[model samples]
Target: MAEKVRVGVLISGRGSNFVALEEWNRRGDRAYEIALVASNDPDARGLMAAKIFGLRIWAKSHKGMERAAFDMLMDAELRRHNVQVLALAGYMRLLSPEFIRAWEGRILNIHPSLLPAYKGLDTHRRAIEAGESFAGCSVHVVTEELDDGPVLAQAKLRIRPNETPEILAQRVLKEEHRIYPEALDTFCRTLRGEAQPTISSDLKK
Candidate 1:
């Protein structure tokens, strides 16, 4: 059996996507192990969810800490766990450029919208308002620029007329759950020097 790749996940909310990754790993393929789950918000539900999976959890309040200081703490924790890859699943905080440089290609993020468009908050709302025909999610490398990295995979859905942002968000979230794990698995495989699977950027509704 091959040694599992160690992974550290960062989350800010319910961590539905984090749960997806965890569940995927539990199926006995043993390609990767979720070594740690860390959150900036002590109250984040994801921390509790991580506990349910019997994974180690770390929480710190980022309210008053300087950006670099906070990120340094996170970096240290991840390193302590010997994490080879980091995944940002709705982690909310914008990482500093210094942190990005340190991790380089090792960090991955799943954004709620197609990249190079709706790069920031209110992504679903902005896409709806822009009269887009499609709205979806993108899993990509984490770079200094937010949501501007090379897309490894995407799950797209056609936008229905009269669709509210809330409704669209709920629908797109399902796709987010589906593709994030796939992208992360592919990423881990690449790190392990295994045969890389053909990953598609387009996932039809």
Candidate 2:
């Protein structure tokens, strides 16, 4: 039997998407393993979610730590877990370029926007304010430039004119739950050499 792909997830919020990934990993048919959950916010609720699954958790705050110091600590934790692939679900911090280059194409992130659009926070509100016909989420490979990485997969939903930010956010959340795990499955399968490299070449550059 082939070995399961080890995944290390990073989150900075309640971890709704993380919950979905955990559920997928629990299924007997899946080919991936949940190796660890790391959070930049010490108070992030995802830490509790990780505990519920008995997964190893790492929490580091940048309160007094320098950028390089924090990156070094995070690098140590990732290496400790021997994480073959990394996923960012609602992770808030801008990872240092050094850290990203070290992990390179192994890291994935789920962004609330369709991507190459609203890159940072307030994604839902901005989409609504723009009167967009559609708003969705994206799962992309992490690159040095924020949200500029090659796209893996995306789930899009039409925006209702009357939609509030909260409503739009919830709708986007549903797409996130679906696409994040799907992208992870794609990534893990590729790593195990069980699948062809379906990821976009644009991501590596």
Candidate 3:
């Protein structure tokens, strides 16, 4: 039998996507396991949610520790948990190059834009402000540069007229939850060896 893929989830917000992945795991179909959940913020609601689901949790505030040291701590926690896959649901900090290299293709992040497009914060606002015809999310490998890694899968949503940034954001978030787990599923089952990431557009233009 193949070893179950152990996963570590990193989040900075409510962790809706993380919750979705956990829920998906409980459905008894996936071969992945959420071994740990780590947050940079101690106050994240996801931390509480993770506890309710019986996941190990860790937090390290970024205010005082140097970047490298903080990453070392986070990396150590992931190692301790035997995390084979790292997923960033809403992690807000920029990871260092060393950390990225250490995990390499093992780490994944879900960004709220089509990527190579709106690559940073306020992605929803930027997409709406730019009057984009379509906007959605991308789950990609984490690299040193922000949102510049190779994308694994993407789901898109049409931008409607008179759509507020908040509304567009909500729509994008829905897609985020839908695709993150699906992307992981693909990675584990079909694309584990290929590693040839591509643009999957069942939901977008």
Candidate 4:
């Protein structure tokens, strides 16, 4: 049997996507194993969820710290666990450029909107206000540019009539849970020198 890829997840709030990844690992996927769950917010509910699953957890307050310094702390924690792949699951902090250069293609983030569309927060609201017919979640390689990385996979849903942002968020989150694991699986396979799956759309021109 091949060794499982060591994955570290950085989260800020409820880790529904983290739970999905954990569930996938538990189902004998053998593609990756979550080695660490770290959060900047010590009170993040995701930490408690991770604890319930018996996964190693790290929590530190990033209040009033330099970006590089804070990211270095994250880097140290991930390295301490020998993590090979990092996933940002609802982690709100923008990673410093140094951190991005160090990790390069090894880091992944799941965003609540299609790329080149809504890059920052309030994605659902923006999409709804723009009268978009579809809103989805995107799993992409993390780059220095916020949500500007190459998209690996996306799961889209049609906008329901009169759908508010909160309602749309709830719907899109389910797709996030589904596609994130799929993207990670493909990413791990690529890391192992295997043939990459064709799940990704080309980088937005």
lDDT of 2 by residue, 1-205 (tens): 8888888888988988899999877876676888989988889998898999999999978778888789889889988998888888888888898999899999999988887899988998998888888888888889999898888887778887688999888878877887778778877888887775453211110
Q: Which candidate is the best by lDDT?
A: 1
Off by over 4 Å in 2: 197-205
Task: Give one digit per residue, the lDDT tens place, for model 1 in 1-205.
Answer: 6678899999999999999999988875846789999999999999989998999999999999999999999999999999999999889999988888999998999989888778889999999889999989988888888788788888888999899999999999988888888788888887788857454666565
Better of 2 and 4 by TM-score: 4
Candidate 1 residue spans exceeding 4 A from truth: 197-199, 202-205
**Per-residue lDDT of 76-159 in model 4, one digit per residue for the tens?**
999999999999998988899999999998999999988778989999999999999888888988888888878889877888
Residue pairs with backbone atoms closer than 3 Å in model 4 (clashes): none
**What TM-score would each prediction reach against the true structure?**
0.95, 0.93, 0.93, 0.94
Q: After superposition, how far is residue 80 of candidate 1 from its true place, in Å?
A: 0.7
Preferred candidate (lDDT higher): 1 or 2: 1
How many backbone overlaps does candidate 4 show? 0
In TM-score terms, candidate 2 sits at 0.93
Best by TM-score, which number? 1
For candidate 4, the per-residue lDDT at 19 reads: 94
lDDT, candidate 2, equals: 0.84
Candidates sorted on TM-score, descending:
1, 4, 3, 2
